[model samples]
Target: MVAVSQNKSIDGRLVAIGCNYEPWIALLEQSGWKTHCCYDLRTADSILEEYSPCICVVDLSNNDFSLNSISLRANKTKQVKWIAIIKKEQLKTDAIRQFINNFCVDYFTVPIPGSHLLDTIGHQLGMLDIEASSWVEITSQHDMGLFGESKSIKQLRDMVRRVAMTEVNVFLTGENGTGKELIAKSIHNLSKRKNAPFVLVNCSSLARDDEKLSLLDGTYRNEEGAPFDGTLMLDNVEELSKELQDNLLAYLQAPSCESLDEEMASDVRIVATSSADLDAAVANGDFSKELYYRLNVFHIKVPTLRERGSDIFLLAETFLTKFAREYSTMASTFSEDSKQLLLRYSWPGNVRELINQVKRAALLAEGNEVKAEHFDLPSKANLKQSLRNIKDEAEKDVLVAVLETHRGQVASAAKDLGVSRATMYRLLNKHNIVPDVRHYNNGYARE
Candidate 1:
């Protein structure tokens, strides 16, 4: 099972502070919430430890608790999503402001709108089930940073092993920060070409034709003007200009004897990565279809950090240990609050972002443990945006799968998904996927 970060929705279980025998408690119970009431923060913390409830409600409207009492317990928000209920006048207090901003995920003034409170609670509970329920399998640890215990990562690792032994060109695709480069490198290291020089061609930087040729003629060039017998990875291959695309496709299709020069015969294996949708690019006439097909002889979709579930913590721990030793920081372990924040934040930057944030957090951490504040925890607005991204990515996956299952037929996929053709097309375009119904754009088919 996933750690606390990847658990189920709230089990209708809650700990309500300063709300003993109140009308709110009755409303919650009537709504099927198993309300556990506590008078003080200390008592509530004990209950939270025991129950591990998804939510904790602190109703300060009717209670006479001092602001200090609330501030002292703010750290208790480790894994629980805190909802504060206060009188309208308490909004002006600095302590009250800090309590809400620093601890609570949300707050409401007195005469709370019952519906909105319930909605917020429901949202938090729903977040607990994010991309977690489907994966629970664990795989053996790797010495590298691809350390994950989730089923998705295990499958990805297995695929890497399978593909590494082949001689066909590899096409790695995923979000920009999902470590496509690392995957490519891993493939190269495992392949027979491990002894040869592996070269990276940043396709985006090849703005000028001469500059592109310079990499071919410069980086891995032997004395004979031929590239070394190794792998040549085209990073961000989607950005290739039509001219470069033509040249690359010609080079890949040509036999080894048709070298750049009569004296040289190139022996490099091609591996390319694209963060953009080559199908949509091909459909929109933005990329060369021939190059896409040639590079895609073996395709691997690297799983995003969010899709890897509990691997978030695994990566974080790995980065922490590595950087702690390097940076000589005391931040060895993540505090409970930090762990929750790490899981909740959508990690748009993926593993790359996680590494930077962890390294920075470790250096900034004052004590032995890394706290949420050490990572520059997200504001309420940022958290909402991140959560929305998580939802959007999940939706995009569904759209891709449905469309693929129907052999890229938009009408059929739309009907299967119970969405209108227009809606399906809209989603397809939104996710940068184009239905496979199309004509050529000056690129040859492999058949």
Candidate 2:
């Protein structure tokens, strides 16, 4: 066991735990991160409770790095973010991996560059400040599902709650992947008819007008043989056919009609979502005006990720935590660079794309921290180049590497790359690269 030492005070109140704190302390102090050193695990609780440091740097390289010790410290100082210093090889051990995963926020492998380590510490401190200052009071019960602290999100939550009280048809407008379906679900779950069926139909997926008319007119029943009574969500309603739109309008005009039966006449709340503007569609003569007016009774415009301000960070952290638990990985947070990339990204696909990227990153990440490259996002630096040069270079490198590995066999290389032989040949020609087939017994040669 490593010997224990009394806590030494530093200016910044950041805590460092380990016997090897001398080198790290000097480096951190030089970088303006004045840290108090605590060599004993027993004194860690008191030191943290007294200093209440937002960040703690722990040395996992010490011989005394045991699961019980780490878990004790983590349990005691639940508020502080722990950064682990470990060797790359140490991660191969399952017990060590589990301990780090359970406790650390981020980690630096041994022989870490001074600049990178400092940047990470600074980022953790900054994130802590952001979290402390931006505590938003979520007003509605369904606000947790909406997941945002921004004014726009709070206003939207209020509107959703107010609208959910009545049985009025609700129209939701937002760009694709802006959680329209989630908002619709929230409304259905919070509404008076929540105990009944909440049916969802993607209008764009219906191939024929007859199918659309049958479903919306309450003629088509789900496999469960139950009628839609709670809520009927027509997703991408702007894609409804002209005939379908007329049928919907007619149904809205007269709830009980000659063709409509008593079961179909039951009050089923309609919640429709559209990425396009129904007003513009009406002006363009694509959508029926009467139908548009009927569905536009109570409209809720879901805000995009960009407009949600600090919500991006909150959502990213939420997704990371969720996927980490799901994938059984230790990645608890993003690196400083990854966080910057997430904030700067335009998120053309919005929350859906963010979830996908985070899930994929968590499953594929090798270490405790998720890095920028794990997201597979295009480099903003090279996006302005129209992707022509970068695309060619990347393609050329792949072709050369595959060809060499397969010993100049085009068919095998093409198969491995998931490209057809013809397309591969065209790519080779475009790059002016010729494959050598001299070793072929069939005597097939390419010059």
Candidate 3:
């Protein structure tokens, strides 16, 4: 029998289900628990939807109770913690064991004391409150300094939340302007080591092996004379040389760096970003397979501006507002035409490019409203050669955006764009665009 407790005096919300809920209900009521009871599985969904309870107590002693039905209900209410009350003999059945493992947080035999059951319920409720509180704080305070309301952005935010709960090495792969470093900082800020230092090592920027080694090995101390702790972000990890890759591999293999004591070593976590396809690099023998696997324990692929769709306008407007405040400009909003252009144009440089364009427009606008001309967008000219050139450039921009969206995976890019791999490569060659490499690698060729 499933039932809802009518008592409104309790501080917590719970749902109870089973054949013999009379005894369980009495126990729960005595413990001052507020619960919604559902006797039938058919009505369980409605009760769950209405109350949104954090904890669920299921009585498995009923011969008519279906584990599959309970599992479905549990899946529907993923945030709800389920506690199973079953006969001791039920533990011998593999199906029951699997069901409990998959759907329930805690299980009890028929003779479970009221105190023990209440304690388990209280603990789960406490944890739920903590998680909800953390989520609120993370979302309200620009958790990772990321701005977007698109489904893709929401998924990324959720992924960031899950990743921050652990201290494993993370690999972030995205286009050059997709704010990989920002995501890394967000992870660090949300992690347990938020109070510690977040050191960024741009693998591509360092030319010398010793410089790279010192940074990775924690020999390079900060201004505070402390070794890099908290999180170490290896930006553009694919740019690291084969020698540097080997050194990094060795460092990763070592339990603790010789330069730092155990305390410092234990405090550090690694987060790496790459614009190129590291898996392909490994296949092509350009990157170490061992290091790639080691660093890819948790991978986050940031979405490109185009993939984020209308979020482009959201980001553009945000940038405009920011730059207006910073430059003391009168530009308050984009003209109708300008908004259309912002939506239509393919952003090859992603978020970074949008910020730059918005800042420039904010600085240059003579009136309160920025016009289409304010943006550095393509012109609609009558000249045939110029028109052809404009078309080619637009095509290139789209190809580059899509390629970056897929993190330089030619096959994936082709599939996304609904073009065959051969045609994709042909188009790349036609546009003289190198797939996967950052725009800076070619001296920002489009610029």
Candidate 4:
């Protein structure tokens, strides 16, 4: 453990809980970040309190530390943003995975350079500053998948935090890809049931009904799993079957966890999400009114990407860079036309589509700049790209035919094609084609 930095003029305060990476610590110190390293969170409170708003990087790459103690400390210190560093293989363990899911706002899988995490740290600190100043007690930014300055996003973030403080059932409505599930998890993480398990039952993809759900008699029993102690998230609730709806409604009415003894009674909060309008579903007689009302105690509507104004650029850039890293591409920026098109288009698929398009663009781009044609744009762009594809295919076919006629001789091919040998080579390289010539005992043959 090391002493807290006395430097008042610094970028931010980083409380390293059980972090033993000295080179990374020195790098932060050199970069004017005040860092205090501690093992087992012994002096975490003092450092966190002094920093006013601090970031903690708990290193769980090794099995030398206790996750229980770290989780307990994190539970007590909700004000501080927590990130984790864990071994990639360690993520396969349920305990480590659950701890990361429950406590960390973000996590990095290591066997990576410490320098690679600098940008993440800096970005998180900037977001934390915005959250601290703009909204009270908004601990996680990326964790909630809500990063925007628009009024709709601001209201949603505020509501998530506010609703998280209470134990009432929450109903979330939004487009399919507007991050409704993230909102539910945020509420669960911020609520009193944070320490308990959060179970999600996706109603849309239910192969079979959960037959062991005992909700009729008020005291609920979840068979084949531990007793329900945390939040129960029913995602895509509009698709819930009639039988499941009855069971869920019964549970909502009684809302008690079955226990071996009366002293161990547990209560699980209900959080439901739907992309469709449940009110209309009820009016159309497609959904149960009782179930709808029970889950709609605190309703929240997530905003779409188009409604988020300048946030599209932020999201696009974030996804582009992220996918670039993943795929090792040179797609660093969007061309001017791409940006204009991005703003003008109404994102019906929302953030999910944006992520997919950007990922595809990044992978497709052979240069640093991505173009509108690379994106899954409207018909005009698609037609232009399709034409270009046709031209490329024709050109490649012509090149192959000429090369075959010339018996794979660059000089003969260049002369026959009336183009420079350099151009011929470039064409072959672009199409990723290689021509071979074979020699026989009597004559020459092409292979």
lDDT per residue for candidate 3 within 232-269, as digits (tens), equals: 89999998888889888988888664646865443468
Relative to the true structure, candidate 1 reaches a TM of 0.55
Tell me the deviation in Å of residue 381 in model 2: 1.4
Of 1 and 3, the candidate ranking higher by TM-score: 3
Q: Pick the candidate with the highest lDDT.
A: 3
Encode model 1's per-residue lDDT on 1-447: one tens digit a residue: 001122133553466677646565555556666544445556666666765545667777765676677667655443466778898998888878888976687898877677777678778776534312311121223333346878877677667755665688999889978888777877777677888877898888887464544344324466765656778899988888888888777767776554455454556778899888889999889998887888899888888888987889988998898889998887789999899899988877888899889989989998789988889669657899877888999997887677667766778888999989998878777777655544223211121
Q: What are the runs in model 1 whose C-alpha is more than 4 Å off?
A: 1-145, 211-220, 223-226, 260-263, 379-447
Per-residue accuracy of model 4 over 1-447 as CA lDDT, tens digit each: 423542344345677766764777777778766655556455766676677466777777776567887788776564467888888888788988888777677898775466876677777778666656544443435536676777888778767866786778999999989988877888887777888778787888764456434432325555744455778888888887887778777666753434244444556788889989788899888999988888899999999987897789878888888889989998899999899878777777888888888989999999999998898787556556766887999997887777777677767888998999898878788888666655212122223
Query: What are the TM-scores, per candidate, against the unseen true structure?
Result: 0.55, 0.52, 0.70, 0.52
- Note the clash tally of each candidate: 0, 0, 10, 0
- What is the Å distance of residue 277 in model 1 from its true position? 1.0
Pairs of residues clashing in candidate 1? none
Off by over 4 Å in 2: 1-145, 212-227, 257-264, 383-447
Give the Cα error of residue 11 in candidate 4, in Å. 17
What clash count does candidate 4 reach?
Answer: 0
Writing each residue's lDDT as its tens digit, candidate 2 over 1-447 gives: 122222233222456776455565566667655444445766776777776546777777755656677768775563466777788998897877876776677888887666777677677777655433332222333224588788888777767765775789999999998899888887876668878777888888776545544554666676776555678899999988877777788878874556467765445789999998788899889999888889999989899887886888888888888889877999987899998888877777888888898888898788899999898787778544535776788988888878877778999989999999999999899887788767444222334
C-alpha lDDT (0 to 100) for residue 74 of candidate 1:
55
Deviation in angstroms for 313 in model 4? Answer: 0.8
Candidate closer to the true structure by lDDT (higher is better), 2 or 3? 3
